[model samples]
Target: MAKSNERRTNIFPLALVTLTGLFLVNLLGFIDTQTGSAFGCGRDWPLCNGKIIPEVWNTHVAIEFIHRLVVLADLLLLLFLIAATYRRYRGRKDIRILMGISFLAFSGEGVLGAISVLTDNPPSVLALHMGMSLIAFTSLYLWTATLRQIETGKYQRFDLQDASSVKQLRKWTWGTLIYSFLVVYFGAYVTFTGAGGYFQGWPFPTESYSQAKTALLIDLTHRLMALILFVLILRLFLFTFRLRGKREDLRAVSLQTLILVVFQMLSGALLIITKLNLIAFLLHVSIATFMVGSLGLLGLKASSLQEKERMKEYNL
Candidate 1:
């Protein structure tokens, strides 16, 4: 009975739900940014037109209202998660610290949303908002992953062979994740700034590069950066292959990371070929979101293993 009670105390399922909800809210915010009425609430934040709910309705208002409701839901759920997880996992510094970061990220996301409603929706502004969303998602993810690790009683890699390779892969994975963010952000910048929709070719080869708009140039740069990011992921994939015969978990992560990067690149190409198709855009962004999450998970796992190895050496 005591063991069951302890198991329930952690509230793993609740934490997972809360994190998933947070992701959905962030995704909704992106959707709203892409197709929303910035002035839907008429310069009135916390309340639309000083009312709990506006009497009139429009496409913009509806989308914006849904996003607001989701954010409110996230706020409520996050508070619950903070209180519950802290109580259950108080002994774990990692979980405690990540929960705090999760709270801060939730606050930042709210602030950015309110600001977006009050001001312009430029690509750069949206990129900042996206950055906050990414942080929130990542913190929650690590928090969740840590809890799962604690519950499973498997915190570090036990598999054989090269410790140095795992360490190097960790560095490479971290670098890839950061680089991916920059490339994706630049892509978003070009997107909201109206810089890349006109290029009709598959790989963005236009008739005259010299006579292109600034948006086209920016778009080209974004693509170039994305290609570089892909190569980095590929390098991580090769590193993982070295451990494929030994450690299944690390190798699996690297494999997924590589696969995601390939699909992301293909999706980006399809997005352009389809001439900025709405579905294609969402697909690209969705894949990028998950790709970041996967890469982040790999980094966390690798770092934990590295720390464990150092502690072992010290004890030895």
Candidate 2:
């Protein structure tokens, strides 16, 4: 129990480290967008405007240029983490799997990034690129948590005999994650399509509602998903309360998910109401990133519980 408590305490800090890296990446992207530097490099892959080093230091050039460096830093950090954790927890399949996923997702993020630049920063491509980065970051969070578990020797497998509840939570969690990605994608679309400027006068567009409608639809879908997820989480928490001592870990994960989801929804709504103000935008993206990480953690907990239950049934 002492070891488990120690691991639980350490997990938050480690997760925060990974979250910091993700926040940096998100900030870089936001800076690029705010400065209209999406095409600053002029369709060059791994190069700044087709040169290893640009002789100029214009705003667009600087934003795009620095974003590249930030991505490089993130990649290196993830690689170092994988290497260090694998060396220490070489025998653990869970840790190995998490590391492998993180590496693969990082590689995919690099490819998507290159494609975004090569395609002249197409909206769809850019959106997908951000989505891929989020996946990589989520994997890193899971891996970091797993490493903490190993360090404190709190890595116990679960036995979840009530498969129905497990299945329900899994479905809801997965659905929420997917819907959140779509929200991000549409947000990118709004920026790239310049639809975000529709309400320049605030509240409503004076001329046409087309742009407003599209943005509203995107926002509404995200909001509906948030509501559904909240209900699902509340139900899960209530069920866990009934189960009490039997599923303490699962209950903890459920509560965390609920808290993060609520915050994410609020942040997103505030961003829009504030007219996409820079500070709110940053916080909005940060909360969304946190939500993704939380969802990933919940998924892992659920899967582990299911596996344990299956093993127990087989042994019986």
Candidate 3:
């Protein structure tokens, strides 16, 4: 009975639910954008068309309204997660820092979203919105992954990793994470500017790019960056996989990151083949979101392992 009670102390379930809820909210936000429902609420903040329930409703209004509702619910869940995590793991400074970043990112998402809606949805604002949503989702993901590791008593295995491997992995993981964020921002910009639809072919533009030269440039830049990101993730995965026997956690995250990047690239091609189908576009964005989260997770694990190595070296 005492052992069971002790096991129940971890908040893994709550953290998982909160993370899932936030991911759903981010997806819904993208759906709202793809459907041209940003102004469905008519420049209103927290109120749909000047009413709490939106008296008049259409498909656009419904999508935007539903997105707002989901965001509100996710906000509540994030607050609960923060409070619960603090109460249970207040001694862990790293977890507290993760929670703080999660809270700030969530708040930035809301603020940026509101500003975007009220300002007629500028392209830059919308792009920033995309990045902020990913930030919020990724931070929550790291928090949840950390809690699970602690609950399973697997975090101690970081000490098993050699200092050299930990140092190399840490550098690569952090570099990939930063580069991934840049790729996300560039992709988001392409989407917001409608540059993705300007292409006549996938992987290569078969038609003349004279008409939409600006879009062509934007889309081309994004594609180049995404390709580079894919290579980076692939390299990270291979290096981490080689050390799987020592750091399984890092290997797992790197593998997931590689898979998600592969799917994201495929979805981008599908999006072009389907003439930018809404579903394909959403899938592309969703995969990118998950890939970013996995990269963040890999970076977090690498950092933890490096810290463990340092502690061992210091004989503390």
Compared with the true structure, all predictions reach lDDT values of: 0.76, 0.66, 0.83
Off by over 4 Å in 1: 1-5, 8-10, 154-161, 305-316
Estimate, for each residue in 47-162, the C-alpha lDDT of model 1 and write its tens digit.
Answer: 87677898889988887777788888878988888888777667556676788888887898789778877777656778877877887888788778766765554544355457
- Once fitted onto the true fold, the runs of candidate 2 whose alpha carbons sit more than 4 angstroms away are 1-19, 155-172, 196-219, 305-316
For model 3 the TM-score comes to 0.92
lDDT, candidate 3, 238-297, per-residue tens: 998888777887788888889899899889899888888989988999899889998988
**Worst-scoring 10-residue span by lDDT in model 3:** 1-10
Highest-TM-score candidate:
3
Q: Write down the RMSD of candidate 2 (Cα, Å).
A: 4.9
Off by over 4 Å in 3: 1-10, 156-161, 305-316
Sorted on lDDT, best first, the list reads: 3, 1, 2
TM-scores for all candidates: the values are 0.90, 0.77, 0.92
> Compared with the true structure, what per-residue lDDT tens digits does model 2 show for residues 129-199?
77777777777787776655445545444444766776776676666667666666666666566565445
